[model samples]
Target: MNKLLLGIILGLLAGVVAAIAIPRHHDTASANATATPSGRPAAPHDQVVRLGKPETATQGSATLRPVGAATIEATAHDPHGGPDWAVRVYRGERVLTPRMRQQGTDGVIGHLKCAQLGRIHDGRFGWLDARGTFRPTPPQWGTSSVVCSTPNAAAPLIGTLSPITDPDASAARVRSTIVWGMAGPDARTVRIKVSNISATTQRATPHHAFLMALPARFGQHDVHVGVVYNNGHTASGPANTDRITLVARAPDPNGGLPYGLVTAPSIVPGGAARGETCLFGGGVRVVGDRAGAVDYRRDVLSELEVNGGGGCGSDAQALRKMTCLPGIASGTGDTASEGGDTGGTGRVARRTQRSRTTITMRCAPGVDRVTLQTPRDVRTLVLSPTAHAALAVYDGQFTTGGIRWTAHFQDGHTKSGAVPDVGF
Candidate 1:
């Protein structure tokens, strides 16, 4: 998977080329054609509407009543070229922006504000909802305030994107809806539907999923390099300084369609031949020398869509589980984990969920295996470090429930395991 942060590096290159490139195409039809190769019809813009204000508290089918939620549904066309599309709901400023490709890697990762996303110390599946909302939190003074300065802290999950519709065309149209109602007294959800979108499809395992996180930062820690099998025995290989590699067979027992997600560089022109359920979800753990130097915060924004638009990849569903080793304190947790070394460099600051501390780590180039622990959540695990050094979290316990899990490596190895740790 091409690191979304790489887009920033590319964006920088775009500026250099923009001056010498041919004139921009002004034909809407031509541009639309380039954006939508799937032959799907575009949904009307009116389909995008806000449902209503959320109620303070309301009963639902479950014990936890929704305090606030919004439902938005609409359809929109894929004006750009891509294979898939996703509606990303973000409460703070945009992380991956179009202009990012022009900036340096540091500038790109800076936008993510990885510090505020929460803690890997807990060892639970920590992440900003791909579609969520947040409210502002009281500003902390000094680094603290800088770490948690989200604009709409109260309703953070405010942005969303349509799903990837087709894989055969250069681009596919999409329709999607975003819903929010997790925090606060008023429970509501937002639903927005879009249409006529095209997205790319490739063979991905763990790394492809990590690319979606965008603007990643590697903490100053020892990168734990090893081969993780589904059986639960991780062979500590050499510490990965460049990119860690994992190769597992496709989900299909017969190896059809390379049934998993991969990077854009790995995909063929015709797309996978079979096994279309491959999906990714996981995180990384780094062991660093300094703990205080480590920062675990992140702010996912609305800009920097893939292929110059918006969308992510998907594949087979798998179970996921995370253990929090309190004893473990390697600054190597994902940007969301305990602090470590900062990967890129920049001052593009964005806020996160109110009160949430933002830890911005440097974006590394590697593969993150996403473990499917439950139907409601997914955990992405990184196989290596971006800088080819050692840094990671340590003394952490894990919490897992009822779910089956699998691990695929770059060397064509595979393993399976039951979710670990029922109670944390």
Candidate 2:
């Protein structure tokens, strides 16, 4: 079956979901299913495969309204590295989008772009305006770069651009929701803790959508997925806040590479379905488990995630080695609660040289405060109770000179060092 036709039980992440039916939470948590590839069958009418408001078949379920350009000024090189492309709205000035065409009953989703930019570089969805006025409404949910492209091909941008010839009409044909920031490499190392045992797999292509399985015994409350850093701090999403997806309810015997696995389209942790021009503050993440539950939450720790790279296929037997932690709680970072998508949680804002950049760090236990010093700014953040982390939103980027930082622990002990500029 088609992905849109497939029933998706989205947990409460806060957005308009559409499909054949809305899923319900159950104690079973699909106990009959596991994340491990089973080449399972299709889900029934009301099976709560993943956690969330199930996609519904009802018309008008998911709608798109174009939002304003996050930044008034923007610039980028042409794909061929030719002249800067036309489309001046990205240069500055508030430009209005074409009106969305109404189709009476069955009027649905569509794309939006600055009238001036036409079909080139700048375009976004989910900002409804009658004329040139920017009427501020609550942010639209599930906006991805489906339209925007890297060399014309990248992760799909669901609501941003158009396959439609007329902007007004595509807006009348909107169907489902969208998720963003899902850029990953050709291969990645995904680690999961199944009953306190740490297992790592580099078998995944890790793009668009994929699966990580845990044993059938695990529930939404028992899974966590995301990128685990070598420093022990993890950018993850917990199982609670409804971040579990079971294969039995939505099987994909031929998902990709390592067959039998399914792909859940655009998983926004905490259901960050809202829209923005450009977003920041979080990074991309993914994880694998056997229970058919993958936990991806908000970028709580504010770590940087690596993407735009991943392997082409997954090796089912590639689950190479296992490392056991003392206990579940023994792992640092992500304790419990909310989630994040590929990008950490932050409103859309274009990052400029002077724009504020968020700096975060995970400290050893007893660490109470962390401070950073850069040529342009100095920032300090106090760790929250039960949190071995610190966050500072300040100006300037980490440059070649590096930034000086210090981690202050409770015993008055201080560890200071210069964090080097980073790149992969």
Candidate 3:
């Protein structure tokens, strides 16, 4: 079972369902089987995965086109040695099977050459990009990536990296998808969710792509970009010479999966696939809102994008415990909420510098609204008194479950009270 061939077969099945749901268009969502936290098989197709349109298959100079909507369904075995896997693509009611090489009447699929782009950073799990947008047409969903296997690997081993001659494309890797759904005619907000159902953990990069036909000279200058979180505040980055790169630490060191990527063949202007060259001007500009910094670089010609600092094989587990604490502000110069602390846990004590001016406290479980105010220099007030006493911080959790507590600063001393604990 070659990954490319598997992709074609799965694409055909997905096309059938896609054609029905969206006659003029096709939609794709990736799904994975589930397993217990203790490493036991749960059920087939237990996890529902989705990939939004215009997602980036790999971070490289070559532009990757959108393939068909792909859905992966794997079934766990009783012995847990291996899982049954199947991939499906959606076009119209006409679901076609993946073709390795076209034969006879298979011209329709054969003409559409689906070149595998790259896998996600975690090995055995990646994505494929075929050519198509708006509505899928023949030759649109040609290229695909399928699962391959290797020894002691959690991520699916991806098949070969077509067009590009890279020896690393040895195995098939598991691939994940990002899904976005919105409500209302205005499309006010979209609920974006992602899942990793393979045997490995997949890192999801949140990105927004703008379609623009730049003048041939466009690559000459850098572009300043900013992204607005669900909150009204925004994080701005310097003019990026290439693309953006943002790295997030894994939740648990051992819980994350191993990922890798290799550049595929480049698509020339005349529709010919050629070996990729360094002359192309394409890269990324990664920014860290929490860290309040930015880093940019050229597109990865054939490199794996790993999270934090280590490769997927590296140990990500933290040597020290990371703590989440909530504090309140009462009598202070200025109390502002800085980014939460890291690498401290279990009644960890923290100190603020005098120049800090504003004292922001990280919150524990069940806390919300942190407040800091000044009595003498009202102008120096970080948070108004109205925002004081009632202020609290959240338990580090992205959503829900907060804590209550207070912070007071006097005699150049700061003390916090009533901090609760929420184990990670």
Quote the RMSD, in angstroms, for model 1.
26.6
In model 3, which range of ten residues has the least summed lDDT? 291-300
Every candidate's CA RMSD: 26.6, 24.5, 26.6
lDDT of 1 by residue, 1-424 (tens): 4798899889999997986686665575445333222233332321211222222322222111111221111122223321112221122232333443455542222211111121111222122211121122211111111222233233222222123222122112222222111111122221222121322221122211111111012221112222233434333211111222222212211111111111112122355433222111122211111011112222221111111000112211211222111011112223322122222112122232111111111111222333444433454444333211111211223333354444544454555555333353
Listed in order, each prediction's TM-score against the native is 0.17, 0.25, 0.17
Better model by TM-score, 2 or 3?
2
Per-residue accuracy of model 3 over 106-204 as CA lDDT, tens digit each: 323211112222222112333322110111122122333312112222221122111111101111121211111111112212221112111221222
Evaluated against the true structure, the overall lDDT of model 1 is 0.23
Error of 2 at 144 (Å): 9.7
Task: For candidate 3, give the lDDT.
Answer: 0.23
Candidate 2 Cα errors over 4 Å, as ranges = 1-356
Each model's number of backbone clashes?
Answer: 216, 55, 73
- Candidate 3 ranges beyond 4 A from true positions: 1-210, 213-411
